[model samples]
Target: MSQQPAPRQGPIRRIAGDWHVIPGWLPVPDLGVLPVNAFLLAGPEPMLVDTGLAALSDAFVAALAARIDPADLRYIWLSHTDADHIGNLDRILDLAPNARVVTNFLGAGKMQLLGKGDPARLHLLQPGEVFEVGGHRLHQVRPPYYDAPETMGFFDPVDRAYFAADAFGALLPAEAASVDEIAAETLRDGLVGWSSVDAPWLAHMDQPTLGRMLSGLERLAPEHLLSGHLPDARGLAPLTSVIRHAYARGTTDAVPPETIRQIETLLTRS
Candidate 1:
């Protein structure tokens, strides 16, 4: 008898226009699970925020190819240097040879090597920097982090959109494309385990610092929040409440270890 086929592995949503969210889960080996949500901030040339792992590169490439020229992919920005976020660099480079890699001062030099330091395309970003590319302009603020020296988030002045990288976020990948209520419910359900009184990795975050970060995110009041991993495009006050509480109380709610581990296992092939 033939074996049952595996379930399809791919993105969850395909929204249209200047703002689009392509949500997908990316797996990693050894480290843990990570959700990579590839985005296109459309301008003269759309910006590819973070490339999913090499394993999922084709899905992202194909998605963009259908809407825009794969060659027109002009900017590939790094929120941080964590492997899950940066795993698919080689494959992305292969598809968009002209795309410039952007990141803040801390990882700028390293990103140069990662992007092969193509002088014409490699850009080193400074904290509190302003840049215009592909007809879109953005202001940036690089926050000091536990790992990366200058990991920052970008604010699109025109659109009121904030790309917050890994800061001020939550994961609801499976429920995207559904109504805001459904997505918010899914996000809440997933985080219960981590937000439980006894969360292991919740220890990683420093509550005071996280609170400050949350405050910054509120001040921005972005119409859309484009996170680095696993897009939750649907908007809601409750979801924001969870994220705020998580930071304020230093709760883990399982995303750091469990979800990250599961994603890594599925995305990585032995």
Candidate 2:
């Protein structure tokens, strides 16, 4: 049914040979894993996707050191500007002096406001622009209703991984280390638990925009979707079906109010 291929690298598991989630030793009390699933792009020129946070930097650095030369990090391909996504950005840039910063225009501006991502090293990505890196071609795409205008995600042709920013991301945030467990919790309370807490923006989403977003998502048919906050794949099947239904109903606000009322009732039962 859903792809649960052998844990790619034993208990730890590597989604792609080049990308693996390194577990951290010191997790921030209720903040889940210290470093939220950092992506290690290993090759002649390696890079770190998103650094954890200040609280987790020490352990994160040690983890990075385990499999990398630190200096070998050529660029930090940040997916978004959230703290967990860029917590250790300044420290990492200083550590990996050779590495430049790669993110969309808005993200770069945010980093600059914080006195990070110096202009010379700042790389801005436009939609449809593709670049070559470590034998992989990265194509950028902008998701609708983003927190920032320049919020964009990357699609890698080599590993066929689509870094879909916040789009298709499962959890509201990586507040817990156990992605699988959280995935279960969301279901236990019914599908509404997640949408109620995380998808609040859905109420304001426009029908046309929803159509466009789904259109962009269908293009990737991503095997691996790493979002800004959510990363659990357990909801792959149900979420797909639910999102499809929502899009269809969005066509003209045709989804009757009665249907929504029923959904609210279901939420209460959960």
Candidate 3:
């Protein structure tokens, strides 16, 4: 079996009002490092967006404790059942006894299958339901591309921030404190490379349909874009533009050959 790389935990930092990011990075061998982030909404009703990596459990729990007591958490928003997103679900649940997991029916079912989350503690949201907490109204958003059908992204009206489950994520050459630290071209290439691997369907998607979805997200005009595998982005335009231009004609040429090779390697390994 191939050895997995150890994930490095980053310091907790506040990205917006009452929004703190607990960041970590997983090296992807030759590709680069992928950011694994979990957000904390430190408000009257404290909520955690997603749990950090299980490999970094000690650091993750410590960073979380530094900001607020785990027992004070009111909600644990499960973006999806993906390991990277929910690695510390059970651990966090044990610590945050009062916190209910916010997810859709499908997500809850997946959790049950994994024997992780408690069904009684799940707060399932129906389609198109607005989750109101701590003076923030969160509207469910379906990202243009995703690896899992259960993925649930959201937009917070109060902070004008959009949490994109796995969309707009990029594999960077190094750990960046913020998106501004990376060069534009490098960021673009990284975004394309990561998306091509994570959501290969993007290359085969209908141009018009995909265009409409991206356009609608752009119309939302979110001031802050939070991604599970990216440093906090300042706005939605840049990320949306990268996806738009990459798939303008539904061709694979936009994706680098090396990225395709990497995908093939991953498939073979799987």
Q: Give the TM-score of candidate 1.
A: 0.72
lDDT of 3 by residue, 122-222 (tens): 99999999999898899999887788899999998789899998899888889998998999998988888778777878877777878899989988888
Q: What is the C-alpha RMSD of each candidate to the true structure, in Å?
A: 5.1, 9.6, 3.1
Better of 2 and 3 by lDDT: 3
Q: How accurate locally, in lDDT, is each candidate?
A: 0.56, 0.56, 0.85
lDDT of 1: 0.56
- Quote model 3's TM-score: 0.92
Cα TM-score per model: 0.72, 0.70, 0.92
Please provide, for model 1 over 1-270, each residue's C-alpha lDDT reduced to its tens digit, 9 standing for 90 to 100: 854222122543444336566555532332222345667776687677766555555666676666677677788887766554676666776778888878765676666655533455667776677888765677885431223455666777576676756543334334334335444556654444323312343346677765576566567666666665434443324544665575456554454566455543554431
Residue 205 in model 3: lDDT: 78
Q: Show model 2 residue runs off by greater than 4 Å.
A: 1-13, 22-35, 171-199, 206-208, 232-237, 244-270
Those runs of model 3 whose alpha carbons end farther than 4 Å from true positions after fitting are: 1-5, 249-270
- Candidate 3 RMSD computed on C-alpha atoms after optimal superposition onto the true structure: 3.1
lDDT tens digits, residue span 1-270, model 2: 653211111122366657655443222222122113667778877877777545556767777888887888997888777655676788888888889888876777787776765688776776577867787888876543344455667777677676655454332224443346465545323233233333446656666666667666656766665554444343234444555455444332322455445433322220
- Model 1, residue 37: what's the lDDT? 66
What's the lDDT for residue 15 in model 1?
45
What lDDT would candidate 3 get against the real structure? Answer: 0.85
